[model samples]
Target chain A: MPVQLAIALTHLLSRKRQTLVSLTGIVLGVAFFLAVSSLMRGSEGDFIKRLIDNSPHITVSDEYRQAQRQPASERWPTGAVELRRVKPLTEVRGIRGHPRALAYIESLPGLRAAPVLVGSVVLTFAGRIEGVTLNGIVPDKMKQVSTIEDKMIEGSLEQLAANPNGIVIGAGLARKFGLAMGSVVNAASPGGEVRTLKVVGIFRTGNANYDDMQTFALLKRAQGLLDRPNRINRIVIQLSDPYAAREVASIIERGIGYKAVSWLEASEDLMSVLLVRNLIMYSVVSAILVVAAFGIYNTVSTIVMEKIHDIAILKSMGFHARDIRLIFLTEGVILGLIGSLFGLTLGLGLMALLARVELKPPGATELVFLPIYWGYEQYLLAAGFAMASAIGAAWLPARKAGRVQPVVILRGMG
Target chain B: MNPAGREGSPPMLTAERLGRVLPGEVPVTLVQDISLTIDRGEFVAIMGPSGSGKSSLLYLLGLLDTPTAGRILLDGRDTSGYGEDELATTRLRQLGFVFQFHFLLAEFSALDNVLLPMRRLGALDEGSAQRRAGALLAQLGLDGQAHKRPHQLSGGQRQRVAIARALANDPPIILADEPTGNLDSHAAANVRQILRDLTRELGKTVIAVTHDLTFASAADRQIGIVDGRIDPHWRA
Candidate 1:
């Protein structure tokens, strides 16, 4: 088969003009196949990875307990206390009166819980005031579920342990407000009292949107500032396996009698965009390959007519119609294989080139870095698609060639 | 009749009432009710003016067409009963043909061109087929020219390559339509002498279509056709 393929390619090569056109058609089909598929799939990968990082591992806040509901122990002597993560949708969970909620969750198969206090507040420094989400977390508990520790640019978790007034400011907010390590910023609670803290660390979490808005501090400091002493809005659960996000959320919802939210529940819009982008990319790229299929049909059919005399001579000389058909089909396969190899190289080259290219924001300063997003599985899938298209395009013409009557053609020529 | 009158009844190719209707706005019957028999190891010439069914008869005899009427017989078996596939098999194993233009695949070398039929039939692998093609070409006085393409060779060399192709399968009979029509007198005479010697030496039957009297005279038998029918009784 290799020898036959080599001979067929040699014959095609002898007619250089025709060979060039056919080869170009094949290469274009394959290259297009790889390019769009990679971009779309890469975008999906980037989005999913970001979504996983942006939210808690799993959250079971309130089904009906209201945004600021407090545990009975933490409630005022006669009045209900107000403390909740972001505003609760509704209801309380199994953690009521369970101070060992974190230990209890950790003991449950595959579940680990971290107590987090999410409080939105106003930050005032030098005369400028900006709204912020103050996420109060224990350092070790935060590391279990968040990529935060991995992203810190300066200052150690020990520094966080050392200073009771220690806090971390996001790089985006720090740049915006002229704040730095050791600088003082006054944080005001939603209820209007002010507390000042010295910045101990600054974290640059590559995600532009989230980095601009988040701040971190010790849970006790957040509790005092928010006037929710000994009360937390949510116990965010972490799991060993990332896929357990949905399953554990479901388990918490069913077993704890509260609404458990996965990342998808939180960022439905983002997930929707991911799905639509994949759909559009596949649709548009496949339409392009379909157009390329026509090129293949035209090329193979033209080559068939050009090689008619050769075909006739072979038929008259005792070549079976089937072997002749197989030759053309195999020719299509060879064209596809060659085109795929070339496309794989070209696609990889494009991806490599794109990776180094720095896409700066329009009208923005040089501080932001946007790394190119991609992975390698994209090339193999694209090659498979291109080969399938080539074979599909060549099928009809090959069948047409197989059915040509040698006697009719020979008689006509004579 | 007792066609060849040869031992073991050397297989004969017999065409009976064969006709071909050529396609156009309206059908044109190129040949009608043509019947003839040529035996193994005989050198026969069929001569006629243009449009006289000489080439048409060769095609029918070669099983390159389904006759409009009647039957073609090879080794006393009815060929009309054979399907296209069976007919092709019969052509590969028993029938050979040479055309006036010597339709060598222009891209292939002389030896490769000769080996084409056997290769198509898968009768031999590449190595054995090449050796057989080499032997046939050497026999046809095309030793070193075997490596040359048809365009790279002369008119004589190309015709010799076509002749080698006809004999590649060692078929029982050869059907040639104007075997010398495209050659110069020197090449035509050489081709004619080669056909005569082929019967005497290789003992291969050859049925040639030609109008040249000198070429016709070299054959063991001569038959003339005019207006699509053979006139064996007409002698010029």
Candidate 2:
């Protein structure tokens, strides 16, 4: 080995207690950095997954982003055409040429599109009345585009297809109205149409408001009850790669001239909140490494102080200033290397322990395990940050060591 | 006696009006206007009282400390403009220093301490450097103490180890500051004889600072210093 490295090792080894203390600080710092970051990122991923799975990736609605330009505006092209009191003509509130639009949407690869005619209605059963949202769906297409089929507890969405007037309601709504499978409920639309629809399926999604207010029925029957023939106001789409929704939604809007909004655009506020959460987590975790770096600085500085004579001797023997600096800097590197080794091992163990921890949320029947993301990138990030901190801490003392004058030290000793 | 000595042998080391002042609130001059030359195969001693700057002059000549004014010439090269790294390289290749204390690194074995300069210079591979270090130690009568740490060896043994270290790179010039100042009488005599033999047997130029009259007598020439200036009339 080179003498500089040898001397550095000797110096650190001789001061065993100080070296161990500094090492312990770094070890704990890095371990906690990895463990906490893993948990935070894991939970973030879990939330995004729930957000993506429980909702449509893209929703193409009946409305246009802007009304069609007036015939007068188009005829006079560069002229000032400020026409006042312009009112739209009364017509059915649904997308025109929806069959051709749905065909265009379905042609896109890796996407499942279901046409839904959603309407507000009042349901009365046993003289108990509740306002609810009724979603009209094509059973087979909805099964492909939604997880409601998987959430079914009593009957299937296929039953809604088999029975023309059948409906699927949440378990919460069923319990509130004391309704069950095959029970008939009177549904009244705004057009003064009333229908007695049989409850074919009950689903519980663990969301109280959704369970209490929403129901699904066949598209044709809904169109009949809602007094609109062959009209679907929305097309709900699920993509194989949900993150591609933004690009696909824009393309759909451009192609079909209807407003298509991706889930990412709709939940932009929530995404920003997650980003702020991550930033806070990183800042808090990095503070630990910075504190650990201070311990390293203290230890290395003390070593430099105690070994001034030895430094003088080495310098007198023709060791350059950089060599002296390298000697002390190597001490920091050694400590960082060993500390990171043990820290990574401990961090993995901590993550495993965290992953096994169970928590029972209020009113929940089962315990949910804490999420721990086992990404290799976090390990790399933790180790890189630790080394930077260690080296940074040692820099000042190493510069001091490099600036020592051998003659003065030797004269002082004499 | 410009480039070489009286015998036409090239001067191994030269100092031309060297001065070092500690520049501060009240400037203290450690060495001033010191000019001297010691040719190859010369053994010289500098004798002075305490605080007379004997070690300061030695440091200047060895290039361990830079002169505030004037210059040093080693092997016909002027070194006044050399940077710190260049001076260090020059010292590693051409000069060696032994202090009043043994100054061997405590953590390293005697052999390892001797090998330090050779390792730094890197003129030899690891195997050859190790061999040369062992040979030098054996020649210094430290045959069985090569593996011993500084604290484990006697004072005399440690000083011998330091001498072995100084000779590790085989530099023509070896500068010693009171090489026997910390030794007992018998050990001091032994160290004095070894430094003398280095000039006689190996043709090495040696300059040492000492207060022992007997040690000064063993040198080819003696120079006395009083108050940082060479005193021409003083004799040992």
Return the top candidate by TM-score.
Answer: 2
* Error at B126, model 1, angstroms: 2.8
DockQ of each: 0.40, 0.72
Lowest-lDDT window of 10 residues in candidate 2 chain A? A359-368
lDDT of 1 by residue, B98-127 (tens): 877888877778887887777766768889
Off by over 4 Å in 2: A77-87, A125-128, A175-180, A190-192, A360-366, B1-9
Off by over 4 Å in 1: A1-7, A64-95, A98-104, A156-162, A285-296, A361-376, B1-3, B7-10, B22-25
True-vs-predicted CA distance for residue A339, candidate 2, Å: 1.3
Error of 2 at A400 (Å): 1.7
Q: Estimate the lDDT of model 1.
A: 0.75
TM of each candidate vs. truth: 0.87, 0.94
TM-score of chain B of each: 0.92, 0.95
